[model samples]
Target: MSIPFGHQQLHNRYCFEGKLELVTALRISSGRASDETDAPFIRAFDGAPYIPGSSLRGAIRSEVERVLASMGKEVGLISCTLFEKDACAEKARKFLQKIETEKVKKDAGSNKQKNELTAEFAKLELCDVCKLLGSTVYASRLVIEDALPVDVAIARNHIRIRDGVGIDRDTGSAKDGAKFDYEVIDPINSSITFLFKMTAENVTDDSDRKLINLILGLLKHGLHVGGKRTGGLGKIKLKETDNAFYKVSGFENSTSLWKAIVNGEKIHNSIEWQEVIKC
Candidate 1:
C-alpha cells in the first residue's frame, strides 16, 4: 500500500465489488410525481432502475456512522456526526480553513506541495469516517458506481404501487385529501440482484482501511437505501461470497493507463475482505 502525502495521488486504487439482493420492497423516489405514481423509482436514461452512486454512498456513510457511534468508544475511537456539525468535524473544518487561508502566504512551490501539506494535516486531524468518506478538507477516497438491477425484466415485473397518507397526529386519523400512492419493488417477488462497485485511492491507514471493510460487513447483515425506511422499504443484503476487493496498481507508471488498456498492469493484491476483516 502507498501513502497519500503532501498531495493526493493515484498511487494505488482499490475496488470493492459485489452483488447485492433486495431483501424487501424498495422505493427510491425520483422526488417528483410520475404519470403512473405519486412517487416513482428513479431510473437511468434508458428507463432501467438504478441506484445513484451518491445515494448509495450516503447510505453507506450513514450506517458506518451509526455503527461507530454504537461501538467506537469501546475501541478507543470516536466517530463524529458530520450532519449534526459535531465538535470532531468542527475541529477539522477549522484546521482546513486555517490552512487554506495561510496557503497563500506560504511558498507552496507547486500545487502538489500545497496538496501535500493539506493532505498530511488531514491525515492527522480528520476523523476515521471523514478520512475515508471526505470532509471540509479531504476528498473522499470512496467512489461508488451506479448499482443496476442484474435482471431488468424481473425488476420491471415486480414493481407495484402502494397507498400512503399524511397522518393527523391531533386526530389520530389520515389527513383529508392527502392520500397518495407510491411505487415500490415488490419484496416477496422482487428478489433481484444489483451489481455494486466502488473504487478508492490511497487508503493505506490500517484504521481507515478497516472502515471500508466495516461497510461491507454492515451491508451483508442488512441496510436500507433510498427512502421510506419507516414503511420498511429499501432493504438490501450481500451474500457470503459477494464482497470482492481488488487492489489495482501500475496505472501511475503505465503509459497505456489513460487509454483504459492496462492488460499487463500489476494487480497488486486481491481479496475477499469481508471474510477476514473486522470492524
Candidate 2:
C-alpha cells in the first residue's frame, strides 16, 4: 500500500520563526499640569513622543487585524489552520449532494436542486465572511514581545493642545524646540548596543529621506554604544558583523515609503521585516 502523508513537520519548522516587530509612537506634552488622576495633562513636552512597547504591541495587533480584515481572513483560530479540515467537511457532503441532483433526468428536479444548491454554495464561497476569521487566527500566532523605543520625535511646528486649545493661546508654546530620540538595545546580547540618535526635524528632501539619513547616521555611529552608559539609558550598538534588514513602514501614512526610493536611502517605516542584529 502507498503511504499518504502531509507536510506537518515542515509546517512546524516554518511556523516557529519570528518575522515582525511593531513600534508605537509615544507623546508627552510639556508645560502642562496633572489632573490628580496622574494623567499627563500638561503642555510640558512638545509634539507626539516616542512609542512604548505595550502601545506598539497593541498597535501591531490592531494593524495585523486590519490587514487580515482587508484580505478577508479575520477568523479567530487557536492553532494551525484557521479552519480545520473538518470545518467544511459537511459542506463537501452537501456539494456532493448537489452534484448527484444535477445528474437527475428530470429538468424540474435538476433546476430546483441547482437553485437551492447555489444559495448554499454562496455561503461557503464567501471569502469576506471567513477571511477575517482566518486573519485573526493567523495574527494570533504572531509573537509580540515588549516594545522598545526605536525613535521619538518632538515636532518643531507641532502645537500643544491644552484644555482643547492650540499652543498660541496656551501657557506653553511647543517652541522649546523638541528633542527626538529612540532606543535600540540588544535583547539577546547585552555587550552590543546601538544608540539611534535622531535629531529634531530640519528642512530635508522628504520626510522619509530625513528619517533614513537619521537612521543611517545612527547605524554609522552606533559602534560606540557599549560600556559607555552615560545617562544610564538603554541603547543598542550596531557592529561590523551584523545582518540587519529594514522593514516596511506600517504607519497610517503610506507616502513615506517614497522617501527611500527617491533618495536611494534606507529609511523604513515598517518594523515587521526588520532583522535585529545578533550581539
Candidate 3:
C-alpha cells in the first residue's frame, strides 16, 4: 500500500474496518436518569446510541495485558496499579540511580560502562502494551474511533428495557426497594450494526506485530464491551469488512489507497494477522 504525504518514513500501517454484532443485549450505560428509565445506553446528541472509543480501547488493552501476563512476560510496568504506584516509583528511581552510577563509573574510566548502559536501556524501555496504547512518556501508535450505528433508524428498534433487583448478601434474597430498570440493545428480534475503525502505525518490531495480532484475535472471538457482564449483557462479535497494510514509503496518489481500503480490495493478504504470529 502507499504512504501519504508528510509520512515519508512511515513503516507499516494496519487499518481494521469491522462491524460489531450484538449476540445478546448490550448495556453501555450513560449513568443518567430519565422519567422513563433509571439507566440508559449512552447516546449521541441526536439520541442515537453509540459506543465510545475509549471504552473499546480500554477493554482491548486490558485483554492484551492479561494475555501478556499469562505468557509470563514482564507486565509489571504496563499493568501497574494505584496500590503499586509507590513500588513502581521506587523501582523507577532505582533504575535512574543505576544509570547515574554507570555514568559516574564511566567518568572514572571504567571499561564496563557501555555494557551497563545497554542493560539499563533495555530495562528502562517501555513494554509492548505501553508502546502501542501509550504511556506518560510517549504517544500511542494505535487509534480507535467511536463506533457509530450503521443505520440509526434501524438501531432504535433494538433498544429495550430490562428490569433487575439487588440481592442482599446476608439474606441471599432480593433487597427491599432495590428494583431497577435499564435500557439495552435487544438482539433477539433485531440486529444492530456498528462501524469501527482501528489504525496502527509504526509496526516494525516483531513484538508489536504479535501484540496487534493477539488483540485482533480477541476482538474476532468476542468481547463484553459494556456493563452487566455477570448478567450476560454486552455479548458482541466483530467482523472485519475491510483491512489494508501499507509498507511502502510513498505513492503517487494517496486517495486511491484510502478508496481501496474502504472497498475491501487491492490488498495482498487477508485481515487475519494471527496466522502470521506464533500466538
Clashes of each: 3, 36, 0
Sort by TM-score, top down from the best: 1, 3, 2
Candidate 2: which stretches are off by over 4 Å? 1-25, 28-38, 41-50, 73-141, 150-162, 165-279
Choose the strongest candidate by TM-score: 1
The pairs that clash in candidate 3 are none
Q: Candidate 3 — which residues are off by over 4 angstroms?
A: 1-10, 72-124, 166-175, 240-275
Residue 112 CA displacement from its true place in model 3, Å: 30
Q: For model 3, how big is the CA root-mean-square deviation?
A: 8.7
Distance (Å) between predicted and true CA of 113, model 1? 4.7
TM-score of each: 0.80, 0.23, 0.67
TM-score of 3: 0.67
Better of 2 and 3 by TM-score: 3
